[model samples]
Target: MLAVALAAQFMALLDAFIVNVAAPTIQSELHASGAGLQLVIAGYTITYAVLLITGARLGDRLGHRRVYLFGLAVFTVASLACGLARGTGELIAFRLLQGAGSAVLIPQVLSLIQRNFAGEARVKALGAYSAVLATGAAAGQVLGGVLVSADLLGTGWRPVFLVNVPVGVVLLALAFRVLPRDDAAALAAGRARGLDLPGLVLLGAAVSLFTVPLVLGQQEGWPLWSWLSLAAAVLFFTLFCAYESRLARRGGAPLIAPRLLRSPGMGLAVFRVAAVMAVNAGFLFVVTLHVQGGLGYSALRAGLTFAPSAVVFGAVGLTWRRWPQPLQRALIPGGFALAAVATAAVGLLLRDGGDGGLWLYAALVGVGAGLSLGFGPTLTRALATVRAEDAADASGLLATVTQLGQLTGVACFGALFLHRLESAGAPGAYSSSDALLVCAYALASVAALGAVSGLVRLRR
Candidate 1:
């Protein structure tokens, strides 16, 4: 059961970064504009983020096993569609569908872990899950590069999407054979409560309004509608919160339980997760573009550039269990510090059109190590206070915010990268010093915040 769950998780997170390495190729081949390419990536993340909380609720109401299988099937079909897409619009549409499938499957993995494991065993399982998440992300870059570069049967970038099909099939079979049967009584109870449709709709609208404009504005030259959409997003989200509060007060199950917000450490966890994930996503996105689009490296070369960082990340994960508690706590800020330094170093290397040599690659390894140190610890800390009954909700909320971080990172950073590129009047030119320097500074600020938070926790 654990293996099957991890396999599904690996696939979901893999898709997130795999498309990143292939982004330039997708853009050139499909004649996609800068904004269109952003959409191809951010669209999936936005949809996944929006539906995550609701998907978790559905799994709680429905059987986790049932929902997991259904979502796997949906994701598999969507992968096929993505691979077969004939245009930019079609690809984005299928990617959105793919996100929906991911949203459905992801929370179940965490919930299943909580259900199946206990005490120390549960902690180890959670640790393993985090390791898998990190591995999937790092592996995506390497695998995507290999698939696209190999161009097996001349399929080019299409194989990246197609690769999920066979893997999904085998997981589906294994899931059925190994996963525990759903509790019939629990399913009936969940069905009795029904879904909060209005809440779901409001949440979706709120997210779409905020994300769509950010993604489309730059490409479309920031029209009036884009500004209007941003404003509307604020209003819709306010309304959703107010309605949810009211619903909770009236003895009803709200979309997000109001009580969950009151749980100790929940808010801090959410913020830290958002900040770290944003940095991770933005850094990877810009680096990929810089290497492939700016430096004129092939997809394989760009992918290889990230290999050292992936290795360092895996090494950190493997050794983390042995670290002293004080050192373990410090790893969060320490990792972020490494990331900030690494980004700055890379920016210097790329300044004035300099070839980023082995030194730059060394910085990337630092970034990966920093990511390994920060991400898992922050996640574990965030969920430490959550009760078992609320595991599904907490998992959903965490996953949602994590993806939102990725979406925000890609949207905001991609916009900056594109704006800088355009202003330089150099097509295919990447100004890492301008855009990446800002990103580095932002990451540095986050690291400082993490350090302060760590100190406060220690005093308590």
Candidate 2:
């Protein structure tokens, strides 16, 4: 059961990055605009963010096992669709549905671990789960590259998505046999809460409004409608919040409980987690693009370059709980600082026209990232202090926030990097030096913010 759950997580995290290495290839083959390529990434993430809370709520209402299987079926079939997709539009549409399926699959995973294991056994299971997850995320970059480079069976980049189908099927079969049946009374009572249809529609609208501008802005040359879309995003989000609060107060089943936001520690924890996740996902996206897109490395080489980070991150993540609270809190901030330094160093190396030093920079950032993201345990612990029913709600919210932060981070950094390249012009065009320098400055700025946020939280 644990193996099956971890496999599901592995696929989700892998899906996140595996498509990135194939982006350039995807663009050329499908004749996609820059905006279309970004949609390949953004479409999925936005849907994942918007539907995550609802997915968790559904899992709670139905049996987690039942919901998990349903999600698996959707995800597996979608993976096939993604691989078979012949054009940009088809891929992006399918990817959005893929994200929806993934959202349903993820929340129940943690719930299952918590429900199944106890004490030391649980800790070990969770630790392994965490480690596998981090490993999968890091490994995805390399795996994507290798698969694309291999071009096995003449599949080109599509194999990355195609690969998930078989794995998902295996998991689904195991899930049906191994997953424990749910408590009839608990399941019945949970379903009594009903779906938050209004909340879902409003949240989905808000996400679509927010994402359309960021995605279309770059490709469409930042037109008036893009700005208007941004304005609409704000308005929709504001309306969503007000409506949700009113519904909660009226004794309605809100998608997210309004009271959860009022909880001091949990609120802060979620924000902190969001920040870290934003930086983490952003950094990965930028670095991958820089290596493969900017530096012109082969896909396989670019992926392999990330190997050091993946190994150390898994190791540190496994031992995170053993560290003292003070150290645990500092991990994220320190990691961010180290990552910034590494980013700067990469810039310096590029300025000097040096080669072969990327491994060192990769190591520094990887180590920091490992220790930093290791704090997930602490964040989950903080949220666990909330009530049981609220636990699902809180976790769902945190997941949504993390996904949103990830989207923002990737778009912001990727945009800045591209912007800098455009400004630098051609001939002597945006050298790797200029690009790395910009990446460094951006990362350093975000790191400082993360550090301050962490310190302030500690003080409070």
Candidate 3:
């Protein structure tokens, strides 16, 4: 059951990053314009983030297992369509479909774990889940490089999407055999709330407005439309909150629980997750650009730079349970601090645009291990207080926020890095390495804030 769920999840997450290394190839082959290429990439994430809560509610309203299979089937078909697409428009449309399928399937993984596991076993499962989440992102880069470079069947970038076809087929089979249907008790709990369409629409609009701008603003050079969209996002979100509050007053279950954030440690823990995830995303973006675009590293070598972090993160995630209880608790904040130091070291060591050597590799390794310590425990604790009935809500909320955090980090830090480069011009102006140095320092600062937030949450 676990293998089936994780494999399905890894496939979806892999698609999120797998195109990065192949973007150039895709653009060339499809005769895609620059804006068209950006759309091909951002459309998936935009829809994925926007529709996540609705998807979570669907799992609750229907059934997790039912939703999982349906989503897998949709995702599988979409992957095939994406690979077969003959034009950039077709590819972009299919990519959006792929994201929607992922949104539908992913919430079930967490809901299943929370429902089925207990005690230390639950902790271990959560750790493994976290490992899959982190590792999937790193692996996509490496695998994308390999698939594009190999040009399997001379198909070039198509294999990245095509690869999901067989895996999804297998997962669909396993899901039927292993995934449990909703029990009477779970069904009763889930049915307590309707789909809440008005709330769903409001929240979806808010997220779409917020994320679309972030995804496109940097490329568009932060045009007036982006700022206006952001302002409208705030308006829509305010309306969403007010509507949700009204729904609660009317004895309706809100799309998001009105009181969920008020639960002890919940808000702070979510913030910590958001902060760390943002920094992690920004780190990946800045470093990728620095290595490949600035430092002139080959795609394969640049991808390999992230391998140490993925390995360490997986190792620490799987093994964290062996530590003493108190030590495990201490590690959350300690891990954040460690991540901050390592991130700062990376900034300093690579400031000159040279490979940071083995020390840089060690620092990258620390990045994953430290983040694992903080993220896995924080996730466990955040959901610890949630009711089983609200598991889908919590999972969807966290997943959506994590995705939003990545979007925000990439937009904000990516822009900052570019701005730095623009300021340091050819009249002895800044290089891409200088921009990277600045972004790395900023990422370290965010890591430090995550540590502080972790410690503060512990006291509560």
Clashes of each: 0, 0, 4
Global lDDT of model 3: 0.86
Please write out the lDDT profile of model 2 over residues 1-460, one tens digit for every residue: 8888878877986887788788888988889988789889667676776778778888779878898899888888988999999898999999999988988888777667666666667666766765765566568888998999999977788899999998999999999999888768767767887778887888778877776676557667678997887788888888889998898888997888777777656665766666666656666666666666566779898888777777776676667768787876666557555655665555555552344475655655554463355345545445545555665576577667766766677778777777776776751323545775677677666766655555555323
Q: Model 3, residue 92: displacement in angstroms?
A: 0.5
Best of the candidates, lDDT: 3
**Compared to the true structure, candidate 3 yields what TM-score?**
0.97
* Comparing 2 and 3 on lDDT, the stronger one: 3
Which scores greater on TM-score, model 1 or model 2? 1
lDDT of 3 at 454: 73
Give the lowest summed-lDDT range of ten residues in model 1.
451-460
TM-score of 2: 0.89
TM-score winner: 3
Q: Once superposed on the true structure, which residue ranges of model 2 sit more than 4 Å away at CA?
A: 28-38, 117-137, 324-329, 356-374, 427-430, 457-460
Alpha carbon RMSD to native, model 2:
2.9
TM-score for each of the candidates = 0.91, 0.89, 0.97
**What's the true lDDT of residue 261 in model 1?**
86
Summarize candidate 1's per-residue lDDT along 1-460 as a digit string, tens digits. Answer: 8889988988998998898778878998899988778889877777777788788988989889989998998899999999999999999999999989999999999988877788766766777777776666668888998998898998878999999999999999999889888777767766665677888889889878877776667668889998899899899999999999998888777777777888766776687777767777777777777767777878788877778877787677656767887787677778767766776777777766666677887887887777777777776666666676677778788887877777677667767776777676756444544555565566556655654554546323
